[model samples]
Target: MITKVTYLIATILSVKAFPQNIQLLSQLPSDPIEQPDSWAWGRHPKEGFGYKARNSLTLEQCIDNPETAGTVHCDGYDYSYPVELCISMPRLAPLKVCADAKFPKDFCVSNAANMVKAKGCQKFLTDMCIMDISLATSQPCADAEFPKDFCVANAVKLIKANGCQSYLTDLCTADVSLAVSSDCAGVKFPASACTSNANFAILDNCKGVEFPASFCTTSVQIALLDNCKDAKLPKEFCVNGDLRMIKAKGCSKFLGDICSQSLELANSADCLPAQKSVSVFRCTRSRDICLSQLCELKVRDKGSCPQ
Candidate 1:
């Protein structure tokens, strides 16, 4: 009877121990399951967000998978597509968001004011404002902005009050004039403001302002004569070589003689190549013989030229 009881107890202990041993074996750590390197979460254009298994699955398949569902989040939501996914996947190439977005009128003006305070109005207009502000537009502008016309109106007011010398300086003179005549039409600016800068004196809007005689230096005179001699009026205004002309004329006449007869020249078929060469005179100064030949041909009748 004692042997039988001892054997039975031993059997019971062995059964329990067997299960305990199995549990211990189960608890031991094993190699981790490797995740696919190509898999990542991305935003879906229409369905919000999902995982993107770039190597193994298409965008549609990833979105369709039950494991990839999520909410969208992004700063420039109105101006961006596949919105939240752009922010979520920082490792991916950046998307061009708000590329064509324009700042709200009040907000743009306010931001312009802040920029002016930081860097002065000259830097704001010349350096910052001239760049494409549309790309800089974000959710704030979309949410709080007004119409573009309103923005232009207020911007003009800001310029008038703070002084727009830098805005009206150099090539900016023509750009500002065009803006005034078209989109900013009927927006009156002080004549004094236009005439203040010698650069603006040549523009039609700033007519009656005397051409500063001191502006035409020896280099400017040479460039003007070289590039514009024998060229016709109205058709091929020396607009193409305006930068070179401006550089030759110095800062006093920074706004080259774009509208004048002396500076106006032919950019017509005969002179196009020569005009191009003249435009880059600083680079092609040694090609004087080529330029003279082209210029001579420009004035001669078609029949007089050699084949």
Candidate 2:
């Protein structure tokens, strides 16, 4: 059973800047395959799509070849993951960075941006979609430390430069993969030019199986779970804390989800209902917070306060 814990909505609303035409997406046509289900198994329908079936090498093949990479299986299997999965974590670039008549043409921004506009012009919405993609592509991006837009932005650059192509069958795939395999994306340097500051290529999430259940490090997860009190947190989050609940940050905007934005809709509950809330960036997993806002104001329940 799902628990609905009450939360004290924040009194303040933090206004964010959304673009004037960000809502122009209703004018764009969506790709049907990009719908929810097909995207999960990482299906890529484009031509040069899909991985090779023989990506995994057996011990015998490796022993005979003496040049085999490893015994593990790779997505190089006969199907390509969705483009979204390839660059799973998404981050928004300025409308300027990805703004081209040719964007996502050959562009994913066309699809992602549409999803962005439909969310009523909010970063949180954009972030959530990207996060979901990141999870599909790699689990770590779901953590607070790994924002989704970041992945989207980076992946866009890689795809655009590659001219839409890849899979193990092609000796040369997309630019990002090409760069990694050939070590020429400038993501790294030649032996003479290599430095610690080089932009490191990271494996996507599920690929990072032993990655300590957080992005880049363990501390980030600990701090977030500590703060939010773990409303709907997954277990991968840490569980070390006082277990005391605190007023959730940005509760007003997020509060509506706990019940109804309309007082009448929420009050429809015959009795006091417990509202469950999960903070956006909590790291550690802990007990759910139980909250009640309408009453603590100390107003008399009898007469009713301002609607």
Candidate 3:
């Protein structure tokens, strides 16, 4: 009898000799032709559009060759694996950078302005004013550190060039008290302070936006619309640290499946009665049916769904 150690050594030798010939596959084994049950195996429909077969290798033929494996058998076997396997996908540009066009133009300007201020690149304020602010903000600035006084002066130059002198004057006037008093220590700047400084542009809930999660980030102008404050949603769907839950119910019409805006619909009368949730059908036969009937509903409706 071949000991386990002997079998392992043999396998290693075989692998080294025919490394390129071995092919692995994901399919389970079919029963022998002589078994009546072999003819009764269930069938599935042809793959639908966009369906991709899992990436796997086939090693049956390689192992069956006597020259490759003298006595071991590798075919006509079925095994269920506990762990899932997947092929590595090639790296691609991040969706946030590539999909910036899909978002509001203001977001680009806001993002660019943030980068400029974050890096303390006061000397480039004039260059930034003439260049594409949208693209500039997507990448880090080359030189981000500079003297605070220089940055302050350069910021004034930017505000003037960007047609924001009056706005800055008003803001600085209003903020003078905070700057001088103890409140200055606790005052938190807005996320888009640079853009707001330049043109009074600010994105509401800017921190909450994420690609494929929320359709797009919204502004305070949209959130403050009628009944926006009274909207409510289940606690589970709310993003932590978001102060926008009160407007969720009212803003549900504008959000996507994975965003904070969708949380607003958690309290909809239609969903309240249905005990079935998207989470319940995750890993069973019911999952396919549930996805086909319900989860797709949300996707088809662009987020105002699962009702």
Q: Model 2: runs farther than 4 Å from truth?
A: 1-115, 134-307
Residue-by-residue lDDT tens digits, candidate 1, 70-173: 32322212233243442244221122342222333333334442332221122224333423344123222222223333334445433332223233322233
TM-score, every prediction: 0.19, 0.14, 0.18
Residues 164-205 of candidate 3 have per-residue lDDT tens digits of 332443333243332234422333334344133212222222
Error of 2 at 200 (Å): 10
* lDDT, model 3, position 212: 22
Model 1 segments more than 4 A misplaced? 1-67, 71-134, 137-174, 177-180, 197-307
Clashes of 3: 9
Q: Give the TM-score of candidate 1.
A: 0.19
Per model, state how many residue pairs clash. 1, 27, 9
Predicted model with the maximum TM-score: 1
TM-score of 2: 0.14
Q: Between the candidate structures 1 and 2, which one is better when assessed by TM-score? A: 1
Q: Runs in model 3 with CA error above 4 Å?
A: 1-3, 15-19, 23-104, 111-139, 143-307
* Candidate that would win on lDDT: 1
CA displacement after TM-score superposition, residue 154 of candidate 2 (Å): 9.3
Q: lDDT for each of the candidates?
A: 0.34, 0.28, 0.32
